[model samples]
Target chain A: MSTPTETETPSETETEGGTRLSYETRDRLYHLALYGSAALFSAVILFPIYWMVQNAFTDSQTVITEFSWLPSPETVTLDNFSVLAAGAVPRYVINTIVVTAGTIVVVVGVSLVAGYGMARFRFRYKESFAQFLLLGYMFSPIVLGLPLYLIWSEIGLLNAQIGLVIALSSISMPFAVWLMWKYIQTIPESMEESAWIAGASRWRTFWDVVVPQTKPAIVACALFAFAIAWNDFTFAQILLPSQESTTFAPGIMRLIDQGGYTSWGDIMAVSLLMTVPPLLFAYFLQEYLLKGFEVRTR
Target chain B: MTVHIDNMTRVFDSPNADRIVAVDELSLTIEDGEFLTLVGPSGCGKTTTLRCVAGLDTPTAGTIRVDDRDVTELPPQQRDVALLFQDIALYPHMSVRKNMEYGLKIAGVPEDERREHVAEAAALLQIGDQLDKMPASLSGGQQQRVALGRSLVRDPSVFLFDEPMSDLDAKLKRELRPVVQRITDEIGCPVLYVTHDQEEAMTMSDRIAIMDDGELQQAGSPKEVYSEPINDFVGEFIGQPAMEFFDAHVESANGTAAVSMGDHTVSLPATADELEGYVDSPVRVGVRPQQIGIGDPAEGIEAEHVLDEPLGDETHSIFETEFGDVTVVTHADFDGDGDTEYGLVLDESATQLFDPDSGVRIH
Candidate 1:
């Protein structure tokens, strides 16, 4: 194949140079248009984040009086960050981290075992059980919020980080289980059988073989669980409303509602601060997240 | 270890259809160090039987014993059996060494001993140089060898293979068959292998058990099963191009019996006395492709030439006979044009007779 192409190159080049020049120009223009559209789409998606970061760097006075389309480095100040650093921001950050981490631990651990069970075992009403989990996922979190709040209060878990963690995890569980079950189905059951025949117990087979094979899905699930817990405002607002116990979402809301005037710089700083962890998580998990959908058994 | 399976059955119940009896009441024993193969068509329950033996699947009602110890209720790990899968399920994340050592590690074998066993098995498989590479990086044949090595390092009492070479190309499958045979022989364990390929079963097993529709049809040596199949299904299924069947009526006169098909009559051999009761009644006659010879055009049963398939060493001449299309293996040098008539002579001793109603071989 290559030999024919090599031999044909010289005569073809002499006869087709003009036509090839036009074709190459058209190809260049087509690629230019394609890249132009992609750049436009990316800018449209990232502009708001850019604006937020710019606002975070500006002082309160400049943000309120001299709002600009482009960032002006001369007016940039660390006052907003310093102000946030000195206040309840650190506590709220810690609370958010704890709730997110706790939600991930509970969701990933429970979903993995449940997902493996649903994927590998033949049990009564297994399909109905999977449908039920999906139904829970389809219901709006707000609908379950009031009932969950009441239950937490009755159980003396109100105003606690653990309560917040539980509430967020409940919301995340159904989707996590659904994702994990679908991912685990792609893995061949023979791998587990081989492990078992190799003298590994069921638990050992799960941790040693299944877990490593399904790591991409687990990481993707953990990131999603973390995102849900970190961004939840309604649950935190209802379940743990106290100043010290509240998460960043509700805490930031409280910061805005408590004053006579809106502090633009402080709000921007806090919002920017709150976005960092999820952004970092998504950045680091991007590779595995892509792989999670395309996972196949070797 | 000798493995005994008694009255084993497996049924799969689903909401959409009738409960499927995947494996009927099947019983057999594999003597110590014997290599037995379960050969059948797709849905024949051979794989299910192997799974039950490996304890990967539990039989509905039966006891499976290894060395006289009941392992019916034990999990696969406790059964002390090694099962190699058709898909070569080596851990993708692990290197060849790690995959082979995994079982020993689970058994709490010390690191030094695990390494030694892995090295020994790798050397035996000629995979010592590839031990550090991951499974995904290996070729299909190499991966299969690693899977075999993984099972071999454990030194289990019984070995079960589920069509382990089904995924390989023809050349690779041919090359690996003897390697597997040699390895199983060296291991000196009772082995139960399952495959739908009859040629593999014929060449590799000490005894071949044929199954159909979840029922065990026959269990015997390859020659016994091939030459003396208990039923028509086994006779038809055990050969390539399969055994050709002719609808014929048996007639006996003056103590001489013959089968008549269309205008041709082939005399039955003396061994067919068991079929004498079916005289004047319809019976199915089977003749293996290799047993049908092309003689002088005027001397034997007449058939119209359909096509000739030259397969290097021999040519299978397909002919349109009164009994339908029949394939006969002839010498490679034998040349016959299509649309011409030829004489097909059936070897009397090799002819098979089966009852038409039940498909049971008469003699």
Candidate 2:
């Protein structure tokens, strides 16, 4: 049976003004455009991810020799994942996790204190200082990497995970502070004053009142610092030349650049594994991230 | 404990403009269990004074003493005072119970004691069932109760409310005013409440302190301030519908003073020696709307009927006369029709005379 057309159905809810398009038809057209663009953009962005997943499940020989839209069920194997377990991939991942966690801790600590001060305190050149913070954020990591490398070498922190953590934190610190400062501004001063009048010292009030209200901003800052430290390659490669200190991003590059036949299957498998932490973070904390950027007054 | 504010002053230094004096050498005292309301127009420094008492804002020049102990140099947390903000300032992330428990916890009260105090406060505020609910989940009145509960649990030496009921609806304000008064009575502390609403001041305060231009105009019981305002500003400000002023010529005969506005004249007692200086000169006469009698043209000064506004139980009749618009409050049943002439009768006992230039009361 055929569905009814616009001409045949003749919508009773047609709007009175401007145009003859029925409300339902207009709504449907708007949603179609919206969801169509979303789906197309998602596909464009996700195609490489789809390919990586396909390569990750296939045997190394099959991934190097064959190109297929869909893998044959019989040829699909868990051997590529087994190759990862038998190699240094897990160690590199652990290193990446360590750097990301350290970056988060440092970034969150500095940003909370600095941001709260910026939001609440009054002092000379405070506005100028806040603007200067974003200036550091504007510089590319490549521009900072060499100077940071020189600094780390001079400080005897080179070829170490601690060096990478400090470097990553510096890169993300400005943006995290700016985010937190603006977010904290939305919280009313009365809340803090109320706490103070309730017999809480300034420090106690900051921890009890300001910190809890800043959960969304804290989560967003952590995710941002995580992404910087986890996906970072230029700083990691330049700072940590030793094999033992290398993280996932540079370690994956080393696996591909062995000067022989490249392991496409192994690269895709490790790359797929490398994407998991950030994916999981974004999946769970997307609500707070949205709230962090929301224009709210509370 | 009694709270004494001695010459409290606050000057705000602005970068781009002239320095502003927010509160100028204001002094007042609140005896224990007394609810004193600082009422004034906007920018009259009531909120600034309250903040100074709470130690949130330091007075540029003053001493604030609670129970004869000077607290002017103390930090807000060190000063034993509880302030309820106009926004109600409840911690949004905390549950009602935790909010009430916050101050107690900060004071290092035992957890069991904190729980007991919170329960007692919640019971007093009628919010026992709301202990587990977040502030956002509660109604406006309930949220106000939670805020009050938070303060109640602290049991501070002084309670400060900065227009706490201003955020509530009219009905809620009427409902909460008595509850707040009762709470303050139960706490038996010196409460400093700040508001610009004169009705709230009159209905809620044991003594209403009226302020203008960062200076105290008058401080008295509502009835005294209403009937015996010390100046034209206080006379005009303290009453609802406000006292109206008219320029009148004074005439003294047989040691008694008679003042005439338009064609109406009212005789005053000989005891008002201040009126002798203004003989045949213009004096400002301020009279409340309820005190001005309205009747037929034969009774007194003739005025053209302008409008009659019904205010629930009373009608405010506006009349255009030789001395500007005069409003008279009468029974709700009295409604003036268009184009009718009415006479305004002013009794000397009900009218206040002031110097036209200084606005200081002449009698």
Give the CAPRI class of candidate 2. medium
Give stretches of model 1 more than 4 Å off: A1-44, A137-139, A291-298, B253-256, B271-275
How many Å off is the CA of B180 in candidate 2? Answer: 1.4
Angstrom error of the Cα, residue A144, model 2: value is 1.2
**TM-score for each candidate, following the candidate numbering:** 0.91, 0.93
Clashing residue pairs, candidate 2?
none
Candidate 2 lDDT over A1-298, as tens digits, reads 1235633233444334544666457667889999999999999999999999999988889888888999889778877886567667877888888888999999999999999999999989998987887788677878998888898899999998989998889889989999999989988999999999888888989999999889889998998998889899999998987788889889988999978889888888888888886899888899766775452343
Q: What clash pairs does model 1 have?
A: none
lDDT of 1 by residue, B85-198 (tens): 999999887888999999999999999999999999999899999999988889999999999998889888998999999999999999899989888988899999999999
Q: What is the Å distance of residue A28 in model 2 from its true position?
A: 8.7
Task: Name the lDDT of candidate 2.
Answer: 0.87
DockQ of each: 0.69, 0.70
Candidate 1 at B359: error in angstroms? 2.7
Q: What does the lDDT read for residue B115 in candidate 2? A: 94
* Two-chain complex of model 2, DockQ on C-alpha atoms against the true structure: 0.70
